[model samples]
Target: MMRRLLTLPLIGCLGACSLTPALQRPPAPVPASFPVASAVPASAPASAVPASALGWRAMFGDPRLQRLIDLALENNRDLRLATLNVQAARARSNIEGAASLPTVGLDATHSRERTLATDATSRELDRQTGVNVALSAFELDLFGRVRTLSEAAFARYLASEQGRDAAQIALVGAVADAYFTQRLADEQLRLSERTLTDWRQSLELARLLKQAEQNSSLDVAQAEGQVALAEADVEGRRRALAEADNALQLLVGSELPGDLPPAVSLERQPVIARLPAGLPADLLLTRPDLRQAEQMLVAANADVGAARAAFFPQISLTASFGYASASLGSLFDPAREVWRFAPQISQPLFQGGRLRAELRLAEVRKSEAVAQYERAIQVAFREVADALAGTATFDRQIEAQRRAVSATQRSLELSELRYRAGLDGRLDLLDAQRQLYASRQALLDLRRAEIANRVALYKALGGGLHADSDDAAAAPTESRG
Candidate 1:
C-alpha cells in the first residue's frame, strides 16, 4: 500500500504531460513601411529615444499644461478604472491557476446512534469521533486541460495590463487636446474684445463727424451696425471660453482653481517633438492596443488546447488520512488510524456531442481573435499614415492662411484710406474689415489643427508604451507641432 502511494507522484508526472497543440504567433497583416510625407525629417534614426521615454513634462513646453496632464493622470476616473481592471484580471488568473492543484481540507466529526431492542438482542448504542485531512475531486490534468486554462487566464491578465496602457495613452492625448482648445478659445476672446473696442471708436468718430455735418445719418447707422456686430462677436467668444473651461474641468476630473496659470497665445504655443516616420518592427510592436489584441489571440489559442483536451479521458483523485475510535478518548489510539486513496478515470463516450461542439466553439473564437488582432494592426497603420500626411498639408495651409491674413490687413488699410478720401463707399470699408477678421480667425483655427495633428500622431504610434517590462504608462511623446 505504501509503495502504491509513492507511485502517485509518478502517476502525476505522466498525467501532467501536455497533449495540446504547438503554439504559434499569428502573422501581422501590415505594410512593410509607413505611408509618410516626403517632407518628414529623416535625420532622426529609428533607434532614437522613443516618445514613451520622454515624460509628459518633456513633451509639453508650457508649465501650466504639464501640471494639468500630471493632475489628469493622477485623478482621471477612466484611468483609475482601467488600472483596477488590471487588478481584477490578475486576481481571476490566480483563481484559475489554483484549479491545477488539489484542494486540501481539514474535517472533524462525531456521531451517536441507538439500536432498538429486538427479540434476540438488547438495546444498544454506539458513538464515534474522527478527524481527517481530505483531498477532493482533484483533476489530474492528464491531457493538460487545467494547465491550458490557467495559461489562457494568465494571458488575459497580461492583456488587461496592456488595456490600461492604452487608456493612459488616451487620457494623455485627450487632456492635451482639450487644453489646446481652451487656449484657442482664450485667443479668440481677446481678438473679439480688441475688435469691439476699435469698432466702438469708429462708431464714436462717425457720430462726431455727423454732428459736424461732415457725414450723413447713413454713416452713423453703418458704423453703429459694425459696432453691434463686433459686440456680438465678443459675446459669442465669451460663451465659447466658458464652455472650454467646463470641458477642461471635466477632463481634469475636478474643478480647476481660479489661480490656474494662463497659457501662451496659440501662435506662441510650443510644438511637440516628432517621432521618426520610420520605425523598426520592435518599435511598431509598442502599441498597447495591438499588444492587447495579440494577448487575446494568445488566450484564445490556449483555449483551443483546453478544448481539445476535453475530448480525451479525464483523471481525478480523492483521498483522506485520519484517526477514528468508538469512544472520543481513544480517537488518537494507534490502532484507530485509517486512510483511503482512490484514483478514477472517465472517458466521454457519450455526451450528446457536447465535447465536439465546445471544441468547434474554441476554434471559432480563436479565428475571431486572429481577425481582431489583424484589424487592430491595420487601424494603427492607417492612423500613423494619416497623421504623417496631414502634418505636411497643415504646414502649407498655415503658410497660405498667414499670407491671406496679411493681404486682408493691407486691403483693410487701403479701404479705410480710400473711404476717407471719398474715393470708395462705406460698404467697401465694411467688407474689407469683415475679410480681415475672417482671415485672422481662419489662421488661428489652422494653427490649432496643426497642434491637434501632432497629438493624433503620438497616439497612432502607440503612445510610446512598452508593455513587456514597464508597468506604468510610458512617458508621453515629445510635444512638437
Candidate 2:
C-alpha cells in the first residue's frame, strides 16, 4: 500500500514533465513604422533628446510652477485613485501567485455519539473525537496553466503601475496649464482696469468741455460709451479669473489658499530644451500608455494559452496525516495514527463548448488589445504634431499681435492729438481706444496659447512623470492608503 501510494505522486510528476515540451507561445504582431512628417529638417537628428530627460521642471523652469506641480502630485484626487489601483493590482497579482502553491491547514474536532445495536454477540454504544492536518486540492500543473496565469497577472499589475505614472504626468500638465491661464487672465484684468481708469478721466474732461459749450453732447455720449465698454471688459476678465482659479483648485483636489501663489508670467518664454528633430520607432517603447497597452495584450495572449490548456485533463493531489481516537485524551496515541493520499484526474468529455468559446474570446480580446495599442501610438503622434503646429503658429501670431498693439497705440495717440487740436471727432479717438483694447486682449490670448502648447508638447513626449530608479525605489514603500 505504501509503494502504491508513493507511485501515484511519481505518475503525476511524470505527467507534468511530459507537458513541458509541448508549451508554445503565440506570435506577437509586428507593428508598422511610424510615419514621419516631411517638414522635419534633415539636419535635426531624431535622437537629440530622450523622453525621460524632459522633466517638467526643466520645461517650465519657474519655481512657483514647480511648487504647484509638487502639491498636485501629492494631493490630486485622480492621482490618488490611480495609485490605489496600482496597489490593488499588486495585491491581485500576489493572490494569483499564491494560487499556484499548495495550501496546508490544521483542523481539530471533538464529538460524542451514542448508538445502540443488538447483535448476536453483544450490544454497544460508541463515541469519537479527532484531529486532522492536511494539504488539499494541490493541483499538479501538467500544462503550465498556473505559470501562464501568474504571467498574465504580473503583466496586468505592471500595466496598472504604468497607468499610475501616466495619470501623474497628465495631472502635472493640467496644473501647469491652469496656472498659466490664471496668469493670463490676471494680466488681462489689470490692463482692462487701467483702460477703464483712463476712460473715466476722459469722461470727466468731456463733461467739462460740454459745460463750456466747446464739445457737443455726442462727444460726452461717446466718452461715456467707452467707459462702459472698459467696465464690461473688466467684469468679464474678473469672471474669467475666478473660473481659472476654480479650475486650478480642482486640479489640486482642494481649495486654494486665500493668498495663493501668484501665476507665472506666460509673457516670458519658458525655457524648454530642444526636442528630438526626428523620432525613432523605438522611442515610443517607454511611453506609459503604450507599455500599458502592450501588457494588456500580453495578458490576453497568456489567457489564450491558459484556455487552450484547459481542454486537457486536470490532475490534483490531496494528502493528510493525522491522529484520531474515541476520546480526546487518546487522540495522540500511537495506535490512533492515520494517513491518506489521493490522486485525481478529470477530463472534460462535454461542456457545451465552453472551453472552446473561452479560447476564442481570449483571441478576440488579444486582437482588440493590439488595435488599441496601435491607436494609442497614433494618438500620441497626432498630439505631438498638434502641439508643434500650435507652438509654431502662436509664435508668429504673438509677433503680429505685438505689432498690431504698437500700431493701435500710435493711432490712439494721433487720434487724441487730433481731437484736442479740433482736427478729428471724438468718435475717431474712441475707435482707436477700442482697437488698442482688442489688440491687448488678443496678445494675452496668444501668450496663453503658447504656454499651453509647451505643456502639451511635454505631455506628448511622455515627459514630466517618469518612472526613474527613484520612482521604482519609492514604489514599494509608498502605501496606497
Candidate 3:
C-alpha cells in the first residue's frame, strides 16, 4: 500500500475537479492609442528598442549615475524589504500547494501492560513492539478546494515578485532624479559665484569714478546694492547645493564616495533626450504595477473557486502499514504483518449559513479586485500620456531659453563697453548685468527640467528593470500564475 501511494497514476488523480470560474481579462479602460502630445513630435521616429527594453545603462550614459543606481539597487532598504516579501510569499505558496499531497511519516511504538490472569488471581506482564509507515490526515482534494487555494497563494507570490520589480524601477528613477538635481544646484551655485565677482568689480570701478568726480555717489550706491544682491544669491545657491547633495546621498542609501567620476554639467548630462511612447495598451505588458494588480485579481478569482468548493464534501485518508508483535524480534516477521486503512468524508450539514456568507464574501472581494485592476490600468495610461506630452515641449523650451541667455550676454557686453568709455551711466550697465544673470539662471533651470522629464518618461514606460535588451525577451511568463 505504501508503494502504491507513490505510483504516478494515483498521484495524478488528486484534485480532479476544479470549481474555479474561467478567468476573463477586463478590457483596458483607456483609448487604444495614446493621445498626441506637443512634447513628442508627430514625425518623430520611435526607437528601434522601446524604452521598456532599453537598459538603464544604455539610457543614462553617465558612469557616475550608473554607479549610483547600482548602489541603490543593492543597498536601498525599501527594495530589500520588497525582496524579502517576495521570498515570504513564495514560502506561503509552497505551504498551500503542499496541502494536496499526503504527509507520510515513520512511526514506532513500544508498550508494557500488566493485567490479572483470567484463570486465577495472579498478575501477568505483556510487552509489544511495532514499527509502521503512517499517513496522517491528508485531504484528498476531490472537489479542488485545496488546489484552488494553492493557486490563489501562487498568484499572490507572483504579485509580490512584480511588486519587487516595481520597487527597483522606482529606486532607479529616484536615484537619477536626485543626481540631476544635485548637478543643477552645482551649476546655479557656480553661476551665482561668478556673478558676485563681476558685481564686486563693477562696484570698485564705480567707487573710483566717484572719487575722480566723474560719477555721482548714487552710481556707487547702486553698484553696492547690486553687489549685495549677488552676494545673497551666492549664499542661497550654496544652501540649495548642500540640500541637493543630502537628497542624492539618501537615495543612494549611503554617503557618496570621493572616488566617483567627474560630475557632468546640466547641458551635457548623458541621459537619453527622447523616449518613444508606444500604444497605451502596451502598458499592460510593460508596467510591473499593472501586472501586479492583474496578479492580485487572479488570486481573488481563485479564492472564489475555493469558496464554492466548500459546499461539497471533503475527503481525507489516514492509514498505516507495518507489523505488530509481542516480541521485538518478530516485529518484521511475515506472520506479524498488519495494515490499517481509514478513509473519512466530511459534508457540512449545518453551520448557520456561514458557508454561504463566506462564498458571498469571496465573490464581493473578487469584484473589488476587478475594480482595482482597472483603476491601475487607467492610472498607468495617464502617467505615460503626461510624460509623452512633455517630451517635445521641454526640448523647445530649452532651446528658446538658450537663445535668450545669448541675447542678454551680448546686451551686457555693449552696456559694459559704453559705461567704461563714459558713453552711458552705470545704471544701464547694472541693468544689463542683472538681465544676463537672470537669463543664465533660467536656462540652467530649463535644462534640469528637460532632463528630469526624460527620466520621468523612461520610468513611465516601465524602463530601468533590465540591464540588457536581450533579457526582455527572456522575462517570465504568466502561465505559472
Q: Across residues 1-481, which tens digit of lDDT does each residue of candidate 3 receive?
A: 8688786566576556579998888889999998877655544334568888888888888889988988888788999999999999999999999987899999899999999999888999999999999998988787789989999999999999989999988999999999999999999999999889988988898899889998999999999999999999999999999999998888888888899988878777777766778798887788898999999999999999999999999878999999899999878999999999999999999999999999999999999999999999998888887777778587777778889989998999999899889899888989999999999999999888878888888888999898767786577644423
lDDT of 2: 0.76
Tens-place lDDT per residue, model 2, 149-230, is 8878988998898899888878988998888888898899999999999899999999999999999999999999889888
Model 2 poorest 10 in a row by lDDT: 18-27
Clashing pairs in 1: 59-479, 271-479, 271-480, 271-481, 272-479, 272-480, 272-481, 273-479, 273-480
The candidate that achieves the highest TM-score relative to the unseen native structure: 3
**Best of the candidates, lDDT:** 3
- Compared with the true structure, all predictions reach lDDT values of 0.80, 0.76, 0.87
In model 2, which regions exceed 4 Å deviation? 1-51, 114-127, 258-262, 269-273, 277-283, 327-334, 466-481
TM-score for predicted model 3 compared with the true structure: 0.89
What is the alpha-carbon lDDT for the whole of candidate 3? Answer: 0.87
What CA RMSD would you report for each candidate?
4.8, 5.3, 4.1
Instruction: Report the candidate with higher lDDT, 2 versus 3.
Output: 3
What TM-score does structure 2 among the candidates reach? 0.84
User: How does each model score on TM-score?
Assistant: 0.88, 0.84, 0.89
